[model samples]
Target: MHTPLAVEHGANLKQYNTFGLPSNAQALVRITSESDVRRVVDDPALGLAPKFILGGGSNLVLTQDVRACVLKVEVMGRRVLETRDDAWIIEVGAGESWHETVQWTLDNGLPGLENMALIPGTVGAAPVQNIGAYGIELKDRFESLDAVDLITGRSVTLHSQHCAFGYRDSIFKRHLAGKGVITRVRLRLPRPWQPVLGYLELERKIAETGITAPDARQIFDWVCGIRSVKLPDPAVIGNAGSFFKNPVVTPEQCRDIINRDPEIVHYPMPDGTFKLAAGWMIDACGWKGKSIGRAGVYEKQALVLVNRGGASGAEVVTLAKAIQESVYGRFGIRLEPEPVVV
Candidate 1:
């Protein structure tokens, strides 16, 4: 016998999203497995209706009440799937907390994910965003993922090439967006576990501590400490972390900006492009600690937009737009928001 789908109508989503923005889903179903997703796809009413896949809600901005059926991915599991000579493969449920998973890997003697520690979201959502921090990205550690097609209710496994990962993006965010549900994720933590210390912050930590050969746990702790000091806790102060993506510009554009402002923060990419700091641009445009309605720029980090009290999604968008305009007007570079505005 098949389990009955337990659907909740008019579900309040304020608590689901990290931003704490108020929004309601017309219908919400907690998806626990791939079979649950298939059932949703097979249902007569829901199958035809528009669907919205919701994970940890860390990288989302709900602008209004959702009319579509919301599939809240709640599947849970974590284990070392394979222990290869060169790498360890760990499979995780889509719903598992990203930071917790990173900790779990380290606890289990795995250390490749230390650089991405403290990232707020689910394991499933990581691939969709190709989430990165410090010096490592999700793509670097990714193995493959299992997803259920919304239309056919068919399970599919995709590898790195299929994911089409770019800076904070993947196929899941593009052509396959809202068309399927990621059920499980597999991570490849390479052996030999060399610490990624190229990032300025990590380098600074090394300089300060005089511990050039820090372990994975130490790196994880440092990353968490750095993030805690830079970002506001969602429980205490609602935020979606890094409101905008650091814009990539040509060398000519970088030089132009550099000529105009001698102290602009930027970094060279492997592709020969320059990644300009969005937060620095916003700060240069004088947006730090500024407010629009109940939404405000975080004082410590201009890239993050925070809810002063009970800020609405529209207020957040408005503030983001204002910041974008100001930064563009000054830097001649458009800042792209990292969050998916629903």
Candidate 2:
């Protein structure tokens, strides 16, 4: 018989979440392997307790003390699983930093993830939100993943189709939310490496630098530089990146808004709906750099909501709600927050 790992009681979570919200978990266990999760599942005291799977805590807003047992994933490993003429399959542990994984792929000559550089969070959490940046989304490269069901202690492999990815959403955010813990993720980087450069920032980079034909490495560098300028470093300033998702509207609705504000920034999706820039709407409503109870909108980018200092999660949520209302009142489009508010 093996002894179960010791659980940390009253674990302070101030430094866990990127928003720097102050909160505590009643009990927390660090998960370093599949067996660690199984042990927790089979433990009599812990098996029945509700569990919360925490990755890098980059895309979260904790508004209250967590009553659930926190499973802080710390598993770490990365390797090329297989190489084919058409694609390269790589497996990464759940705890690997998303940004570090992107850079590693580039350093190892894997180019499919260049457009999504600098995204915060962990590899395990990527699929949950279907995180995207510049022009590429995690689903574009996601192959499959291994997850352990907390209740059954059974490990299962799920492919992209099973994940049911959507615009910044997946099963992990819906039906499977909090039901399982991801242990490993596999990404399929297609061969014949092609660069993604359709984003406005990348286009501007090309125009400014006069580099019409850039490589994957160049695109990666450009994404890193652009994000650094637009989004504040969580370490220096507390924030969950891109506090809100861009609103997508029908053509009729978009036409109506465009008639009212001709300068609105909008993009046409392949599905015919128009995606309106939430930041632009917030800025148009004059919310840039505004603060309410220690929570403020980023001066550089209104899409981001920041913690001035010693901000409570409740304050962040209140500020977010206020911004949502303002943007809705002005543009008649309700902005949805991107982070999972707890």
Return the top candidate by lDDT: 1
Model 1 pairs in collision: none
Q: In terms of TM-score, which candidate is strongest?
A: 1
lDDT of each: 0.95, 0.93
* Global CA lDDT computed for model 2: 0.93
lDDT of 1 by residue, 142-174 (tens): 999999999999999999999999999999999
> For all candidates, what are the clash counts?
0, 0
> For residues 1-342, could you state the per-residue lDDT of candidate 2 as single tens digits?
767588999999988999899999999999999999999999889999999999989999999999999999999999999999999999999999999999999899888998988999999999999999877789999999999998899999999889999999999999999999999999999998877877888999999999999998999899989999889999999999998999899999999999999999999998999989999999999999999999999999999999999999999999999998998888888888999999
Total clashing pairs in model 2: 0
- Pairs in steric clash, model 2: none
Candidate 2's error at 265, in angstroms?
Answer: 0.7
Q: When superposed on Cα atoms, how far off is each prediction in RMSD?
A: 0.6, 0.8
